[model samples]
Target: MEKTNTVITIGRQFGSAGREIGYKVAKDLGIKLYDKEMLDRAAKESGICQELFETHDEKPTNSFLYSLVMDTYSLGYSSGSYTDMPINHKVFLAQFDAIKKIADEGPCILVGRCADYALEEYDNVLSVFIHADLNARIRRIARIYDLTDAKAKDMINKTDKKRSSYYNYYTNKRWGDAVSYDVSLNSSLLGIDGTAEAIKRLVEIKENNNNKKL
Candidate 1:
C-alpha cells in the first residue's frame, strides 16, 4: 500500500458490496476507513443519545424547518444549555464535526452518510457510487441476511428508499447518479474485489495527475 493525499468517499446501495470494497481500497491505500464507527464515535463525543444518532443518521431529509432548529441550537435555547439541543440537530452537528475531524487527520476512505457530498468541495477527494442489479441485490441480501426472497426484495426496496431519501435530502442530488460521483460501478458485473481494484487504479491515476500539476 502506498500513501496518497486523497480521501475516498463511497456511497453504495445495500447488498451492493460497498463496505467490503471500501475496506479493501483503504487497506490497499494504507489509510483509515470509516463507517458505522463514525456514528458510535459521534455519539460518544456529542453526549447525545446513541439511538437518536442511529435513527437519524443517514436518514431522509427533514422538513422541520432546519433554519429555525439551527438557530435555536446555536443560541443555546433548548432546555438550558447546549445539552438541551435537539437530538436531530446534535446528531447532525456531531456527524458534521466528525467528518471534518476525519478529513483533518489525513487521507482515508469514508462510507455512507452522504460523505461524498459532505466533502464535495475538498481539493483531495474522490467519490464513488456502487450498485447492483435488483435480483442480484435481492439474492445477496437474502443469502447474507437469511431472509425469504420476497422479504429480501422488500428489505432491499425499503433500504434503498431510505438511503436515497437520506442522500437526496442532504445533498440535493439524485442518489446513485453518476454525475454526483467521480466513479460509478455496477458491482453485479465486476464483483467486490474487481471494483476495489478498479478504484485503486483510478486513485493511482488521479494521484499521478495531481503530482504532475504540483
Candidate 2:
C-alpha cells in the first residue's frame, strides 16, 4: 500500500455502483472507507442518536413539521449555532465535521454525503462523480433487488432526487454536474472495476503532479 493522505470523495447517482467502485478503490489503495459508518461517528460527535442520522441520511427536509419540532431537537446540542438549525442541517453539520476529522486522520474513501464540499479547501482531496445510463441503472437495480424494471426506475429516480436535493441544499455547487467535481466517470461505459482503475489512475496523476490539476 502506498503511503498517501489523499482523501477521495465520490458523488454517485443511484444504482451507479459508485459505492462498490469506492470500495474497490479503497481496497486497492489500502485505505479506510466511510459510508454508513460515518453516521455512527457523527451521532457520537454531535450527541444525536444514530437513528436520527440514519433517518435523515442524505435526505433534506423542507417541511412545516421540521420547524414545529426544531426546538425539541435543538436541546440535544450544547452549541448555540445548532439551536435554531433544522434537524437536517444539524445532521449535515455533524457529518461535515466528522468528514473533516476523518480527512485529518489520513487517506480514506468517502462515498456521498457531500464529502467533497466538506473538504473542498484541502489540497489532498480528490472529488469524483460517478453516473450510469438510466437503463443500465434500472437494470442493475432490478437485478440486484429483484424488482420490476418500472419499480427499479422509480426507486432510482426518487433516490437520485433526494441525493440531489440534499447536496444542492448544503453546497453551492449543483449535484451530479461534472463541473462540480475534479473528474466524472460513467460506470456504464467502463464497468465498476474499470471505473475504479480510472480513479486510481487519476490519483496517481494528482500525486505525481504535486496534487495540482488532476
The residue pairs found clashing in candidate 2 are none
Expressed as tens digits, the lDDT of each residue in 123-169 for candidate 1 is 78889999999899999999999999999999988898999987776
Model 2: lDDT equals 0.90
Reference-based TM-score of each model? 0.87, 0.90
TM-score of 2: 0.90
Return the lDDT, model 1, position 103. Answer: 82
Candidate 1: RMSD to truth = 3.2
lDDT of each: 0.84, 0.90
Using lDDT as the measure, the top candidate is 2
After TM-score superposition, what is the CA distance of residue 175 in candidate 2 from its true location, in Å? 0.4
Off by over 4 Å in 2: 64-81, 211-214
Looking at model 2, report the run of 10 residues with the lowest lDDT sum: 67-76
Per-residue CA lDDT of model 2 for 128-180, tens digit only, reads: 99999999999999999999999999999999999998888678899999899
